[model samples]
Target: MKYTREILSDVEGYVPGEQPKSPDVIKLNTNENPYPPSPKVIEAVQALPPSALRKYPDPLAVELRRACAARYGYDGEDWVIAGNGMDELLALAVRTFVDPGDAVLTTYPTYTLYETLVRLHGGRVVSVELDGAFQLAEAFYSTPARLCFLPRPNAPSGVCVPRAAVERLCAEFGGIVVIDEAYVDFAEVDGEAPPHCMDFPRRFENAIVMRTFSKSFSLAGARLGVAVARPEVIAEFLKTKDSYNLNAFTQAAGLAAFDDYAYMEANAATIRATRARLTNALRDMGFDVPASQSNFVLARWNGVPSARQIFRALKERAIFVRYFDAPRLDTALRISIGTDEEIDALLEALRAILG
Candidate 1:
């Protein structure tokens, strides 16, 4: 039963942010989009033909790719590649262009999945730890990896590196830079931060920008995501992916989801507003709230009970949030910004826990 590779032998797999199944707990885990996707997503799927189940989905996902390009303000279908999720694309990206022994660097405390992907490929996973300020490590400027994984608003901390930093990497470096904009729409604290790489990566052939239907699009269940790159990279990824990785329903749903961007935009606005309220409230309650630019707040209770204690207390009250058991992040809780009512509920429960 040891068919697993050596990489699997000792390596701990990436833990997802968390997804509690209980209906009672206000699930503030797994940075999932709290709102439902566009109504068109529902309508499109409802009208999907059952006959599709009999045949395999389009291996290329041409139409869905086209819709993605259009959404990103691109000219044609050449810039986009669809995936079961951006996660699949991440794995494929490594296998496609990365050499078995090449170095793949990513920010520490980022989507850990990136590290797991590189390790599984027999590649060296070099992490440049974010300094105490939560910015890119100096290693990024001093030495660059052949590939890098970056979440635009980043993760857990939900802080973004400056655009100057990204441009500096793209200019001085010689490898493909992948920017994961999974939560960019929710990354603005007051509309004064970095721009989404998707909004401009077409200008740089070496830069690859990824977008997901999971967060802002609110289609986590649909599991659809797209990566935008120079036409050259798209062709390479096409050659690397499973011929039929995306199903027919996903294509229909993703297309419809784009058609109803306004619906998703409305929901994003609500999350932003609520995120601000919670950040401020947490600060008032003596927590060191990091400036969150995503639909979540990262807070460390000021000399209060440890993050583990707060996590357990909330669990008993049926409220779920993400707690990373790593070193600097040990005391911090990454709370997904939910609906106003959900935040209120969490606060009410917290009051009791601390008292």
Candidate 2:
């Protein structure tokens, strides 16, 4: 009974977003792409012969990495590594770079999984809280940690840090800096290009940028995520990740999804449009909604019905959204941008509840 480690006995684990099984639920609590994956993904999965499962999958996921690299101007598999999901890669980053009793850093109110991963490795967490504008504080640069996890277009709040800020951080930080761009595809940052930090790896040897097929590519259930960095860092990650992390089917599906990039782009465009409409509607209804660059909006209204009341009211109506019960986030609701129909339903529900 006492065989478990002391840390395991005392630590509270990370809680995932709810996945209600009911078909009629609006189901927007997690930021899953409401759109389906490209037709190619479906075809690839269907074409996978049953016999292929007989053997162990390719340990390196060579072809899938190459295909993903081609999109970002990387030369070969040496620059990237795939994982079961971003969660796995996050853990891998901790294992590969952080030592027991070392420190890992990230912004406060970010993806909580970073802390969990660090804790699992017996590393300490150094959280730098964002300021009144929800941007990184000037003092953030001074916090020293061995590995830094920065989510560009951060989660929960869905606000991305500026490119210059990131460059400065990478320049000054002594250790590794990972720009988690899991939601970057959904962001149209400069009006001309997709919001991303992929090029950072080339600019700074200590920089690593990670992406996932879950959001824009509609492969959340597929559990596919990739990270790009210089060859040396990538080699370290390869040593840390599981040998068969990317199974045969996932590799196939990811390749097909990559080949059909246009499909994902179109869906991302639709999501951006819906996000704009939803944000405007929420603001019009007296909610303080931030300018979201990701597929979700963080809204807080202090008037009539509080955020918690609205969360409960919506749940009673079979509509689901994310409401954090922690400090700095208790008053806000992170609502994922669903399809046009789903957004309409949510808006109608909110209108009725507030009225």
Candidate 3:
């Protein structure tokens, strides 16, 4: 007999981007920061006490929350909560708000992990299909779910929905809306004052914004994410979160990284520049490249050497990019912007493959 819950009988697990072992491979599959973490973060990690590992981490992550709250202009530590990663925080949101047989809403062809998380909680997934331009359909506002997760500058496409539209949705949707802004840092990196949805929680009582230290902060390996919400909502999230989810070392690293904001901003500026160059290069090579606000661009080959063929050919040449076989994404490869050298290598490999 199977020793599994009824929900497990037909559920498919989330598939993370591949992490190949070969050091020589030019990996651009996962949206990891090609740059190293801030020097201060490295110093903090190096300074962690070995004895701290023997004790439990602060369950509330007070200092880290304070730093984050200050950065976002939040009133107090009660408005923020840290997680092992955005993945964990997403899961926690589902568990806290979605009951069995309840509904979870999101856009079709999003992060994909959102669907898996809802299914794992035995919640119904109501996916709103994006229109021909990959924009959210009007019906999205009417979705009656217990919770909704929306990714700005959505994945697999790298297109950002307008801030006004998101605000309108938050005003219309009855239930909780979680704005996943894992890539918002990229969109606003070069702007003098980029509009962030973090303030949505204050405006609409039912909204929350999620962020990560991975993409723009160059801390993918450190695995830190946080949620910004109203104090009352954060209190409930704290009730659902696992104790000691953020370890002592990670807290130290996050604090150090947050302290050195200028360093992270410089790296983000570099990525923004590289992303623009990469998008233009792909378009020049006859690929359908969209306007990307994220660190990655989705390039689709409409004719010769389809996406799958190009993906395989690049892998053979020790270059890696992400190719999804799902609907609406089968013909495109999502390429994360690496260093200038790496982007040049990928472009050269693509040229050879196309020829």
Candidate 4:
């Protein structure tokens, strides 16, 4: 009757925020792009020949790799590996780099997936909790923790850390440094570049920068993620990955996304503007807002209703948003910025609730 590992008796696997079945819900929960992808994505998918689908997708995924390399500021496709999405890439990294009993370090109240991924690999997690202001500890630089997983403009709270911290970690930590930039483009679109250690991979040996097409590129359904690292590190990851990780549809769509950079840039700008406006609007309405650099905002109320109560109230109004029960983030709600209309609806709901 007892088949589970002893370590898993209490460890809960990560539950992604709700993707409610009702399309009527104004989903500001998971930070998904409110905009549609470029018209070219539609054109590319439509243009895909039936023959491509019949074939097993390209194992090397050459074209996707090239596009990813260019996106990450690398000159060639040599060290870029695309996965089904960033989530898969992270799982592969843990499997490829970590052996049982090997410890990996991450900041808690960051990406919950890192804990699940490492634990599944029989690797122990060493975590430094977010500081008083909900930032990663400065001690991470002095402490040589193995294989740090960092989320830029970290989720659940859009507060960003300086890039110098990542560089310092890479310099000091002997193990790998995977900088997960799922929200980086959205942050940059918001006019904040909190420093990324992506360039260090080419110069030093242990750095890896990862990205996804799901967020800024508005291709969540595409399920594509790319990792940029030294060629050798990428080779090691390739050994761990399933051959056909990136399928034909994703590759084609991603290429179209890269090619239609102007449309992508415009959408990013609109999202940025909306993020700023929503943050200010929420703050003005008496919510304690974090300085958000992502497409989402973390807001705690000014001693009105508990975060849980507000979340439930919003859900009752047929609008969906994120509410976390974890200790560090228990008192706040993470709200993704949607379109102007969506924001207006959310604000209207908040006003009604407060009154």
Instruction: Residues 230-349, candidate 2: write the lDDT tens digits.
Output: 989999899988778888888899999999989998899999999999999999998898788899999986777889999999999999999999888888899999999999999999
The lDDT values for all models are: 0.83, 0.90, 0.90, 0.84
Clashing pairs in 4: none
Tell me model 3's lDDT, rounded to 2 decimals.
Answer: 0.90
lDDT of 4 by residue, 170-288 (tens): 87887898889888776663355435556878876988889888888999889988899999898899999887888899889999998998887788778878988998898898888
Question: Which runs of model 4 end up more than 4 angstroms from their true locations?
Answer: 1-10, 189-196
Model 3 ranges with Cα > 4 A deviation: 189-192
Model 2 quality (TM-score): 0.98
Residue 287, candidate 1: alpha-carbon lDDT = 85
List the RMSD of every prediction in angstroms: 1.6, 1.0, 1.2, 1.8
| Candidate 3 to truth, TM | 0.98
Error of 2 at 179 (Å): 0.5
lDDT of 4 at 266: 81
Across residues 153-242, which tens digit of lDDT does each residue of candidate 1 receive? 888798877777887777766678888888887766346532677755666778888888888988888888899998988999899988
Q: Rate residue 67 of model 2 by lDDT.
A: 85
Off by more than 4 A, model 1? 189-194
lDDT of 3 by residue, 175-264 (tens): 999999999888853465445788888888899999999998988888899999999999999999888899898999999999999998
